[model samples]
Target: MKIVVSGQMLKYQVRNSSTSRSSPSSYGTASPSSSSSNGSQHDVTLLTTSRSNSLVSLNSLDSSGPEGDWGVLKVYTSDIRQCTDYKTIRVSTKTTARNVIEMVLTKFKLTCRDPNLFELWMELTTKAEGKPVKTILRLENDAKPLELQRCHPAGMSRFLLHMNATGTLVRVYDHNICAASNYKSLMLSSLTNCEEAIDLILAQNRKSREESANYGLFLTTPEAEAQIPPEVSIVSVYVLSQPQHKIVIRPLDSL
Candidate 1:
């Protein structure tokens, strides 16, 4: 059996165990598509990469007609410390900043309780006092991404997908021992502390606060792992978060 799952940034190919191993298939230089065939088990899991930037025509890149060809937009997250690379997306002259933000969230498979909690910003870098200074310009919801990119030079400016300071979207793992990808997204206010975040997750699951005391929110990353203190706000932890960061619920006794 063969199955194909497609997303904005990835295309996954799944095959049954009977098939012979094959060389990976590739697409283009700037944007490459790859395929993997595994034949050891009944099921195969396809992995996603951060390098799937599709190609577009150079002339069509700046077209702004009502029926213009597809254009490309480079998007990156506000979490610069961890997410150092930009993601490429296909956009048209009609695509707005809000629409690009939604596309990015979907590409990353993140669900936010409030989509409005996110915004797009234009980051401009200039030299002042013999030093490089960075300025961020917030884009309106209706602002066009393709047109905006056309206005600025490639190296001097960039588009950033940022979470509003008002609140942060958090992913919470369920209270299970297994390492499962199924999780819930919660909109946490900037002032919400670790303890409050736990309560919110429990409430969403219809669990009681009494059980919350027995649980703790732990953050794990490639470099290090630690349990978040009850008094620390979610925004604080979020600032130091990485792309692969995870906040999981573990029994207090296990910690």
Candidate 2:
């Protein structure tokens, strides 16, 4: 009925108090101590988002409970304080990235000074080269189920959950972040063709193509035009990816 998520107090109110035991969450749907009046429950379907920068852990929830979206997720933390759960988790495919983090807080039975200021980053990479491609999961869709918004790579069931910096609105990162709130950058190899480039960009910017009617990947610089023959090869084409209304430029200095 009523779901409330904030920077602190992780609580989820999907089960009816009558049918379920009283569980505690700092990122709560209802007040942690409050329950249904006539013994009713809320139906909440979790959704997906991208991991931010830092990481969380696994031992944050009840792993022995009834099976839901039972899968493995890695929480990469930089420090002891960042280590919220075990390095890995047994999660459900039905759950979202936001729900996973909240579940972590609930699993740890801890509270944060600012919890809503975090995000989930789905790191897309290859098994061969370990190429880094990141995507920002929408934080607002905590209530939506992942069935419709699945970002997990095929055959690669596991996902990553990263945290933002504390006491700051800015997210600090040392590497190239391919995904975020809006537009993100991704690298295309010289051998990648136009079709392959489109596929690569779309894979990282799922939210982008969904929102814009005029989305495309092309060369924006005259320098590129001069070097790339009119032959139209992926090696010469740089991507100007737009998610929603934001423009993401790749080949940084090229354009």
Candidate 3:
């Protein structure tokens, strides 16, 4: 999707190339590579911002309003850059993070049967090296946005709505030589394919891609465990995975 913010055009898509760099205000760097075993890639941007140049009326919600039963909350999606594309909603003290998500989806005309498929996060901005750095914290379902806002200083935080990986929670471990206790939980978006997941996993583990070319993803379920191909979608893997499913990464020699 494309949107105009601050007289500049911003395009949002599930990116695997470095050609498209996010604005300085964005949380993280864009995807680094486009190499995927899967011939096709899904169109899903993991994180994006939208707030400026909004078509929605801003009559009722005001950011400067005092703490009360009702307040305004700005919600950003993954289609545009920071504070450029957003939907403003009037929230109450009774409003939960899940409630905000439903409002965002409905206002944005997005269709999703499961509200749990999405999550609301708090974006804390701090200055580092003369640039803004963002820290994201997932909000609990019962957390109140309006009330929470009062706890923080002004302009220090904002809310962002993101899609949660619908797949089973997979714990990735090193080869058998490593202790079983050493594992990293991989909970990426369902839109992430196996290839992107692999890159993301390697990045998280701080392993060099050039050195890990022989590594593969293995999915383990209560019924069985098997090595997954790079072409597989995370959604497809989820279908085959049970609640106890996990993804184990190992070199080809260790398999």
- Top lDDT hit: 1
Decide which is better by lDDT, 1 or 3. 1
Worst 10 residues of 1 by lDDT: 21-30
Q: What residue runs in model 3 are displaced by over 4 Å at the alpha carbon?
A: 1-68, 79-84, 127-133, 167-255
Give the alpha-carbon lDDT of every model.
0.59, 0.36, 0.58
Specify the poorest-scoring 10-residue window by lDDT in model 2: 167-176
Clashing pairs in 1: none
Tens digits of per-residue lDDT for model 3 on 130-190? 3344445567776677766765688877877766435455556654424434776655555
Q: State the displacement of the C-alpha of residue 33, model 3, in Å, after optimal TM-score superposition.
A: 17
Off by over 4 Å in 1: 1-64, 78-84, 127-132, 168-255
lDDT of 2: 0.36
> What's the best-to-worst order under TM-score?
1, 3, 2
- TM-scores of the models, in the order given: 0.40, 0.29, 0.39
Candidate that beats the other on lDDT, 1 or 2, i.e. the better one? 1
Q: Write the per-residue lDDT of candidate 1 for residues 166-188, one digit (tens) a residue.
A: 76667777645334436777777
RMSD to native, candidate 1: 18.1
Clashes of each: 0, 30, 7
Ten-residue stretch with the least lDDT total in model 3: 50-59
Q: Stretches of candidate 2 above 4 Å error?
A: 1-69, 79-86, 127-140, 143-158, 166-255
Task: Show the colliding residue pairs in model 3.
Answer: 50-85, 50-86, 51-84, 51-85, 51-86, 52-84, 52-85
